[model samples]
Target chain A: MKEIVKDIRRWQKQDKKIALARVIDLDGSGPRLPGAAMAVTEEGEVAGSVSGGCVEGAVVLEALEVIKNNERHIVSFGYSDEEAFSVGLTCGGTVHLFIEPLDW
Target chain B: MNRKPQKDISIFDRVEELLNEEESFALVTVVKGPPVGEKMIVFPDEKSGVGFEGSLGNSDLDRVVSRDARGELTAGRSGVRNYGESGEAREETVQVFVESFIQPPQLLIVGAVDFTAALVKIGKVLGYRITVCDAREIFATTQRFPLADEVIVEWPNKLIEKIGQTFGPRDAVCILTHDAKFDVPAIVSALATDVGYIGVMGSRKTHEDRINRLYEVGVDDEGMTRLRSPIGLDIGSRTPEETAISIVAEMIALRTGRSSIALSETKGPIHD
Candidate 1:
């Protein structure tokens, strides 16, 4: 979140809508910790990151949806040990993320 | 649960203010309980109940979780915690992520040596507010180590006197001064503070000699144990840059309480 402060302020000055996605929890070998965050603008620009690269695309999709619908959600992505085909961490971890609009 | 939100401060607005100011705070959302998505932000203030927002459905549960959340925020740690609907001990109906926003940890490196330069660079990469201190005015200049956040040409003990009170469990004091004249006072003063890692660099013989001096200065067994003389892990690092990595790795291992073996060599689950 600190990394995107400048960009968030810039976009806000331009009156652009913004959404924030934060990794609230992780299970297994997460690339990033819980506080890792990212921001997405209405124009599809991005700053910061919630994961190494594996789940960032997914987080971006969720951020866009939150901006479009004005809804907040806690989204989890990972493979269960029993399920081999899930979008698990490349390092084999599960990450829980909270996606919300930066209305505040 | 009918309390009004603070004037002009929505829950989100309050969160933004907390984050922007780098104030240590935690946010607790009742993710699975009766009032899902209802949340409260918690910051430590001796004046009880002043900075809280929203509430858990049950007063008992809210009180317990609020207290626990403040503890986590103070420690600058985040994790999921379970609680009963009324914040009882037996039930697990709600899960709250006590998300703590804390200022970055500080790294104080005494003696602006080559190792100090490397440590400052790597420490910054690890998000530490690096301060390089040395009595020699020529060595402790910003031009020598541009990466350091502060360069002070002062005796180590005097600098510690001014800032030691602020040292916490997450901060570090790295004594790169192998000389007894500097290392002795630096280690003595650092021992008096609560800084988590106090690493002193020296050879085996030099460390032994320094131990004698440290004892002469009235540091007992308990205080002497706090120092990590011959600083850094046994990675056989010869270069200053590699030594810096080893020191930072040791610091991380100490903080995380992780076995400093190769992760691949470990047998059980990777993250405990």
Candidate 2:
């Protein structure tokens, strides 16, 4: 979150709608910690990351939707999910993320 | 930069300002409970009492998360916590992410040896407020330890007594002055504070002799247990730079309560 704060502030100055995604929890071995964050602008630009390059693409897509709807949601990706998420960590860990617009 | 010094600042602006200033605070955001995405900020150590803003839907939940956020801030940790919808003791309805942004911890090195410069350099790399102190005015100088944030020429014990109260569980006190005349008192005064790490640098014989001296000063078994003499891990580091890495690694392992073994020998979650 601290690392991506600068990007969020930059986008805010340009009046760009930004969505923030942070890894809130992990169930197994993960490349990142719970506080790992990524900020995505409405223009598809990205700053920081929430995973080991494995699930970040999916997170960006989720963040784009968060900016579109201006709503928040808890999204997860991993092999353990019963929903059979399209992306999973190569480390075989489950990452839970909270995606929401940086509107507040 | 656009924000003026006034009330009614948005939470997002205030958060960016506080974070840029490296202030200690917590941002709690509800991600699971009703009315999700509700957020609040907590400044636990403000003089006027707990400073807070916004809410997580319910005043009760806001109160509870604020309290927990304060604790997490003290521990320098960020994570999600569960609670009942109305902030009950053991319910899972609400999950608020407590993001703590704290100042970097302090690293006080009580010895102006050549090794002290190496430690100070590594300490800065590790994001610690490095302070190098010694009674010898000639040895303790900014020129000698340019990387040190502070270069103080004072008796080790006096130095610790003057600023030891500020030391907390996140801070470290490393007595690199193996000379017992300076180190013994430094260690004793350092023990008076609640510093999380107290490492003494010396040879095995020097360490054993320092133990006797510490005991004579009435530093009992409990106090002795906290000291890490012959400081650092068994990494077989030869040079001062390598030794600094060993000391920093030891401190990290102690803080994380990890085994300090190679990843190949370890299993389970790599990041916690």
DockQ numbers for every candidate?
A: 0.39, 0.67
Among these predicted structures, which one has the highest TM-score? Answer: 2
The lDDT for every candidate, in the order shown, is: 0.84, 0.88
Worst 10 residues of 2 chain B by lDDT: B1-10
lDDT of 1 at B56: 68
Q: Best candidate per DockQ, number?
A: 2
Worst 10 residues of 1 chain B by lDDT: B1-10
Estimated TM-score for each candidate:
0.83, 0.85
- lDDT tens readout by residue for model 1, A31-81: 888778899998889999988888888788889999999977788989677
**Per-residue lDDT over B94-118 for candidate 2, one digit per residue giving the tens place of the 0 to 100 score:** 8888888788899999999978999
How well does candidate 2 match the true structure in TM-score terms?
A: 0.85
DockQ of 1: 0.39
Residue lDDT tens for model 2, A1-104:
76787777788889999998988888878888877889999999999998879998889889999889888989988885566657899888888999999878
lDDT of 2 at A100: 92
| List of clashing residue pairs for candidate 1 | B61-B86, B61-B87
Query: How is the predicted docking of candidate 1 categorized under the CAPRI scheme?
Result: acceptable
